[model samples]
Target: MPRYLFLKHYRTGQTPHPNAADRWTPQEISDHMAFMDAMIEDLKANGQFVGAEALSPRGTFVRYGGEGKPPVTDGPFAETKDLIAGWMAVDVESEEEAYAKAAYLSSAPGYGGRPLYEWIEVRPFLSEADTPDLG
Candidate 1:
């Protein structure tokens, strides 16, 4: 079995949805959340749902200040352009299955029963057991 990550990226200050979530009707928002919940449940049922998570848009970049100093941060730099909205890591039997799942995720609902065709980056995890020794 191999694991893969479905990276879902979002543009900061860029509208992912023509009608942003905040602008959606309360019922529309609820429906959107419900859709996500159902998707997760479906994945779990298939035993391919390893994990998923969402990231906050407001986060800062931290770096070491100096040898004797503390960490330093310029501020919430990720807010400037792009953001990794969230990701779903799954353990599946094949690459095609992973790709299928990624494709399925792209059809999430947006406004008025319309589909949000967001682009997803699908990548596989390196399986140490499957790798050949160089030496």
Candidate 2:
């Protein structure tokens, strides 16, 4: 099974619901958690679930370009438009399988009704055989 990463991308300041700015009530969070639980169960039953996680908005980004170049740049960059919301990694048999998984994930219920502003980017993982291992 090949491993693939499902990345969630969204613009900053996009709320899940019109009233989301008010903060999640306990019931709202509970409902979302229940939906996630169901989704996880379905994934496990299908053997398509490897692992998943949500990431924080803050990140440290480093860029390198130059002779004898030391890495430059630091966290808290000004660009919020291109920030990643989160990611999930899964192992599947083929590209078709990967696509199906991503489609299912995108349809999963979230904060409010649905996350219209969110998008999923599926990418296959690189295997050790595909590159020379330094270690």
Candidate 3:
């Protein structure tokens, strides 16, 4: 099976609803957890689920030009224009299957009575065939 990445992208500074920030009470968190539990069960039943996780927003990116060239960068790169919020990797039989899974995931619930303006980007992972089978 081929591995595909389902990446979630969203705008960083937009509130979904006027009172969205205020809606993050304990009840809202519980409801979100329940929804996630159901989604996990659904994914497992379909046999398309490999693994998933949530990531912290904080990150450090390093960029290097050449050997001993001294990498330059700092925490929290200010380039959120094309930043990826989070992602999930799933193993599927084909591109069609990958797309189907991504579509299903995008339909999952989110805060503010709808998804967080997020979009899923499905990309196939590079395989050994892409290069030479080192074996």
Candidate 4:
């Protein structure tokens, strides 16, 4: 099975819900989270769920320094356009399956119980088994 990563960016890609989540009501936020949880449960039941994580907007970009030196970073950058809201990893039999799953996830409800219709970035993992033969 090939593993795919679904990247959920914050207000960067196309989406019906353009407003920030903070603008939504508390109940709306809860509803959105509930939908996400239910989706994960469904994926788990199908044995396609590998893992999922919700990221904090505050992210630090770290780069390798010289030996025995601290990594260099420009401090936390929480720019909404550059922040990734989260990611979901799924192991499936085909790329189509991955796309289907991502599409379903993109429909997660947002403000006013409306489908977000968000754009999800999907990419498959390259494992040793997928390495091309050079001989």
Clashes of each: 0, 0, 0, 0
| Residue lDDT tens for model 4, 1-135 | 899999998876444237567678888889889999999999999998999999887787789988999988766674566678899999999999999999999988887878888888999998988899888
TM-score of each: 0.77, 0.66, 0.68, 0.83
Cα lDDT tens digits for candidate 3, 1-135:
898988865333443333232356666556655765676677678776777776554555788858878776665563543456567787778899888878777665456556533457888889887898666
- What's the CA RMSD for each of the models? 3.0, 4.9, 4.1, 2.7
Ordered by lDDT, highest first, the candidates read 4, 1, 2, 3
* Candidate achieving the largest TM-score: 4
Give the RMSD in angstroms, all C-alphas superposed, for model 1.
Answer: 3.0
lDDT of 1 by residue, 11-103 (tens): 434555464444667788678678878989998998878898877666677899999998898764745345577889998889999999898
Better of 2 and 3 by TM-score: 3
Q: What is the TM-score (0 to 1) of candidate 4?
A: 0.83
Candidate order by decreasing TM-score: 4, 1, 3, 2
Off by more than 4 A, model 1: 12-19, 129-135
- Relative to the true structure, how large is the alpha-carbon lDDT of every model? 0.77, 0.68, 0.65, 0.86
Off by over 4 Å in 3: 10-29, 65-70, 74-76, 132-135
Model 2, span 59-132: residue lDDT tens:
66778857798777664573554557667787789989888878877665545545433457899999877898
